[model samples]
Target: MENFRPTKRSKLELAAPVSHKNEQFWILDGNTVLEVGGVLFKLHRSRLVDQSIFFSHLLDERNVQMDGVVVKSDENGIVYHLSNTTPKDLEALLQLDKNPMAYYLVPPPFPVLAAIIRAATALRFDTYRAFAVKHLENAWSSSVTDLTTERKSNAVEVVVLARTCGINSVLKRAFYEMVRVAGYGLGDGEFDADNGERPQEISRADERRLERMREHLISAWLQVAVRVDRTFICPNQPKEPTAGTESRSSTLPKCPSLYSKRDAWERRVHDSGLYAEYKFDPFCGLQALIDIKWDEDEGWCSDCVHAKREVWRTMRQRTWERIEVWMGLDK
Candidate 1:
């Protein structure tokens, strides 16, 4: 055989398979080989099996090969091909899975949370999925009283998470929050937190909804909110004495008027955004209206202070309801 195979070899035959390892998660002596996005990850077989039943069955030693690749070349080798999961997601899962004790204490960042939920859901890691959902429920809380609660993810990210995990408890709140912050519309480039390197995957429908809500909110703000408290009379201001029923000496102390207060309120409205370049954040903006100190010493009685607080409270609730209607989420 002058040798059909002797003189030369093709690049395909000469080249070795290309794959990368994530040093952050690659464990020494890990028995299972997991691949995502052409990157190989070595994970402890028992640990993965312990975390998910799907992994347990998928990594069974009884199955020797998958798609012609030797899944278990021997007891020392075990390969599992993963689909519909990204490297970042798998990496997040690896981090979370390795430390079960920490999950209860340290909540992951938004990016990590998004990644874990997506991967855990696809991989059937139920524990991680539930944990992520609970954490997110707090993050996107709908309660106006909990406005001070720190949040790692914004409404945009929450929308993505809700769609991915099918969690609806926070969807309405998320849609409301989206209009509060985001001004982007269809054809605008959005940030893809799920895959930083990829283009935004947000649908045009989402953009349209936000656009409509934003416009409606502005209209509601101008028509209803502005008109609701254009004038606030101090509830504690003494009423005009009825026909001088008693002597002038018996007159109660008059509550001094804050002539500039209404002007200040209007200015706040302008500062927080009546239009584009809005600093309006319903969670903070509505609260800001109430934050004005109504001190009894400043001519405001306790009743007046209470009245101001109550007005803002009612407004906040009303805004939420209006948001539901604008978004077509209202029943």
Candidate 2:
């Protein structure tokens, strides 16, 4: 076609679901088992290569367990099964193949977890807001974090993407809890010492120092976002410096050094609503963006030129409210 123009956003339609009834033989890719009708598949160097000859390989009938699995269809009409397989098993299997399609089987979920998934896939803010409120209507009676933890039903990709989109506050809360549980706290909070030191309360002075450092880091992130694409800040990357960089020079300290401080700084930034305002710059004019650069010290001081700010701004307000409730901000 002449003068063909393509859409910017992904116009991918969800594919039709695959039926398991007619399928006989199957191959396991990580946690996902791909079954082909009356066909046996072999793992070739970790890949699921179809074997023309069918083998009568099956898990012991007694050993085959009944469990729930979540299935989602991709744009290419391929169904994926996702499961909460151990990170260890995932790593072992992933090394064999790089196709993201192979993983699909998932663990059973609580009802709320199902809702979270639907809401996230739809990218519906109202649905996300309603689900979170239903779970946290009585925020004072329970630990907000605990409420979040109980609903462990989504794939890591879904949860992380929801957080980046600034939708599904509950999912984001669950994500942060995972981050915290993994022992990666903000720069302003009490930190785990790698030197075998017992964790203790942090001094107020040190906390303040951490806040400044975190602001510098976040400011730096925004600069990168502007200079590069938003994809540069992948959630999968190491939050702290790598070993090689750490050895080269101590010019930059690792995140572990200022976890507590970073936490406090983030809290202050939240309470002050700087992130919300900066995320959605009211001014989009060229001059306004230039001014943000002028005030270099302040974070997002020049965010007015952000092309995505209009959408991000509305989402920011709603997201912050959900987060405030999740964190028990009234206290």
TM-score top scorer? 1
Top candidate, metric lDDT: 1
TM-score of each model, paired residue for residue: 0.70, 0.19
Query: TM-score of model 1 relative to the true fold?
Result: 0.70
What tens-digit string does per-residue lDDT give for candidate 2 at 247-307?
Answer: 4335422222233433433554445454444332211211123333322343322232243
Clashes of each: 0, 24
lDDT of 1: 0.66
Q: For residues 187-229, what per-residue lDDT tens digits would candidate 1 score against the true structure? A: 2455544445544345667667777777766665554336335
In model 1, which regions exceed 4 Å deviation? 1-17, 21-29, 60-78, 148-154, 172-177, 182-196, 223-283, 294-302, 321-325, 328-331
